[model samples]
Target: MKINFALSAFLGIALFASCEKKDDPAAANRTELISEKQWILTAVTVDPALPLNGTLVTNWYAQMDECDKDDIAIFRKNGVYEFNEGASKCDPNAPQTAQTTWSFNSTETVVTVGSSSFTLVELTKDKIIDTRVHTINGINYTFTETWGIKPS
Candidate 1:
């Protein structure tokens, strides 16, 4: 009878110790929102002055047409974005691709990868809005775009 009581008490203590309660609401929200799944860049907006001209001529002109969905630059969730890779939009002979990692800040206002950071200017139910200011050498260019979310 004493042995049975000791075993029951030990089991009860083990069960209680194993049970844990999560009390952080912000942490839960971040996990649910930012880390929920993968995202892809659906649209890109570049400075009108830069004008995808010269070497970038193709990157700009073909993407400008609203009816040209096939010619649009496609950025995958894997962090690699393809510009003029598949279609004959710009220079089919010369395709360009850029790669970078993706992450959201604590406030979910900005995303950073390497030396580049995009500030969150707006957001919608389907996408996170961002504006990117890129400085190459001494030249700076700004762009606005929306990143579409994907279900995992």
Candidate 2:
């Protein structure tokens, strides 16, 4: 009788331990949202508009040429980033696409493209918000860049 009880207990524990866990993506991991997507630079704004060339600049994206404003940025799973010119090129002599490398820090709070790093203020299925803070001459300015498929 004691042997039967021991065998039953061992089998129960073994069966519970052998249960497989579901392949659920973690909430904190945002890899799925950023990889394999064609994101467009929708807008860029600087708080406390910083002085640039004697002018207080707020909308940074407006400073870009129309050709550059229509470019597409694709972040791939293989760490390669492709900047493709949709239908216009700033320079007719320049290539239609450019390639660069991109990586995220271990914490995934910041993403580095080539040598430049930007803090990720927000990232979702629909959009990505990047920010950079600078203290120039004791003045704090926050530059925010929003990228998405549509107006953000």
Candidate 3:
């Protein structure tokens, strides 16, 4: 009887341990999704307290030039982040390649790349939406950017 009881208890404990959850599954998915693809900017929405010519401005991507629309960013598994301007150059003097380091916050809702931090509004296998807020001259500006996986 004693042998049977000990064996049953051990089996029960082993089963319970096996069912335990490991590291956050969502975080792992986010990391994998972000690292696997090169994201290209698809849309941008900008809201500013100060009106543009006395009119509220939104959906700013329509105003972006071909060069501005060609920016691409990539995050690697090794924590290296890179941004490249496509064939066109938004600024003739701007560096073509921008390198940085990136990591997800504990909650995985924020992504920090070098000195800039972006709030992750939405993320999926093929799409990402992030937002950043800045204050300049007492005017609050919010910029929301949407990116899609670049086609191979």
Candidate 4:
């Protein structure tokens, strides 16, 4: 009788342990969706076909940050975003300054902004990397950039 009881107890403990809930590892590190987060540009990698190096690249890239200490862009958790150059404040007239909503894909690695979407190839403490395949000026290209999150 004692042997049977011990076996039953062991089985019960094992069954209960097997059914215990476990946390998802990926979900724990996920960044919560929020509003008003500022994303600053760090580096940009353009398609080989695009002019992103040499004199053309330097000239256009300089124009991008002409007004500010650096080229910075802010994507608000509330759906507003600003890409400011050296300008003291974001100018609504600037081509890159616009308000838009964002959504994450099931994996939470890809973000959809307005009607366009980009894959989050990687994200780190100081940089958020993304890639978008698009056609600009009738040429298809993949645009990738690394951006830093601004301090609050």
Candidate 5:
């Protein structure tokens, strides 16, 4: 009976160890998470420190139509980034595809796209948040954008 009890305890401990949770998805596969699906901008916050900044911030959403809201961004594993303007055109004369290049900084805290770079605020399986600050003519503007995978 003693041997049987000891064996059972050992088996239980082994089972528990094997059932440990896996590594975090974000930490293990950030690039895969960011590149696997097309991300659409869900929300944007803009803060500008200029006289006309208020109007720009207030009228930001109104400036984009329904189709503009559906614009999707694709991040390729090869470091190519493409922005597809949705079916409806914001400007009929403008090109639909905006191709660019992207790369993560050494620490992976910043994502650089072409000449601009954004601080990666948050990255998860279903959501991403990036923030950017720009200074123009002594005026500072900060923009924060949240993106999510496109619905099936």
Candidate 6:
């Protein structure tokens, strides 16, 4: 009889413990989503590929050197942004990491890192996309950059 009573109490307690509110990923805010993962630049595309030295430059990210390609970024909740030179460094003498302050605009639609700001197009757990329109050589171009969670 005592064994059955103890088992029932254990099961009841287990059930209660399982019922505790857990953080829902879908319900997480932008700050939470941004800081949750180490980001790696996946792609950088420019609309209306610019002609450069007889070749149209569309994917700027692909043009980056292997050393530059492996760099990563981490956004901290405390308004700190870290730019990490992953396993490789473009310049051996350069610091392995750089940090700067970051913040979102009043509406959270724009994210400012250092002196630059980008409009957030998409922000998800696995990926983030930001865009900006810049005038280069008197031509307005839309640049889109994408970042994905660093792969294991």
lDDT of each: 0.39, 0.61, 0.61, 0.43, 0.57, 0.64
lDDT value, residue 91 of candidate 5: 71
| TM-scores for every predicted model | 0.43, 0.72, 0.75, 0.55, 0.71, 0.79
Clashes of each: 2, 0, 0, 9, 0, 0
Off by over 4 Å in 3: 1-28, 48-50
* Comparing 2 and 6 on lDDT, the stronger one: 6
Q: Which tens-of-lDDT digit does each residue in 28-127 have in candidate 3?
A: 3677767747777787677763355566667666656677666677787898877777678757887887776788777677887776677777777777
Off by over 4 Å in 1: 1-31, 54-107, 136-138, 150-152
Q: Worst 10-residue stretch by lDDT in candidate 1?
A: 9-18
Per-residue error (Å), model 2, residue 51: 2.8
True-structure RMSD for candidate 3:
19.0
lDDT for model 4? 0.43
Model 6 over residues 61-127: C-alpha lDDT tens digits? 6665677667778788898877777898767886887777778877667777777677777777777
What is candidate 2's lDDT per residue for 35-142, written digit by digit as tens? Answer: 777777777677898687789888866766677667777777887877677677767886777777777776676777766667777777767887766577898877
Candidate closer to the true structure by lDDT (higher is better), 2 or 5: 2
The candidate scoring highest on TM-score is: 6
> Which sections of candidate 6 miss by over 4 Å?
1-26
RMSD of 2: 20.7
- Give the winner by lDDT: 2 or 4: 2
lDDT of 6 at 144: 74
lDDT of each residue in 15-126, candidate 1, tens digit only:
0000112344423332233333344445555564453334452133234433223332333355443332223333444434333345455665565543445576654434
- Over the stretch 1-152, how does candidate 5's per-residue lDDT look in tens digits? 01121111111100001111236443545666677577776765557622343344433333434766777777788988777766776577757777777777766667776666677777776788776665656766665667788898
Worst 10 residues of 6 by lDDT: 9-18
- Candidate 4, run of 10 with poorest lDDT: 9-18
Quote the lDDT for 42 in model 4: 54
Root-mean-square deviation (CA) per prediction: 21.4, 20.7, 19.0, 20.9, 19.5, 19.0
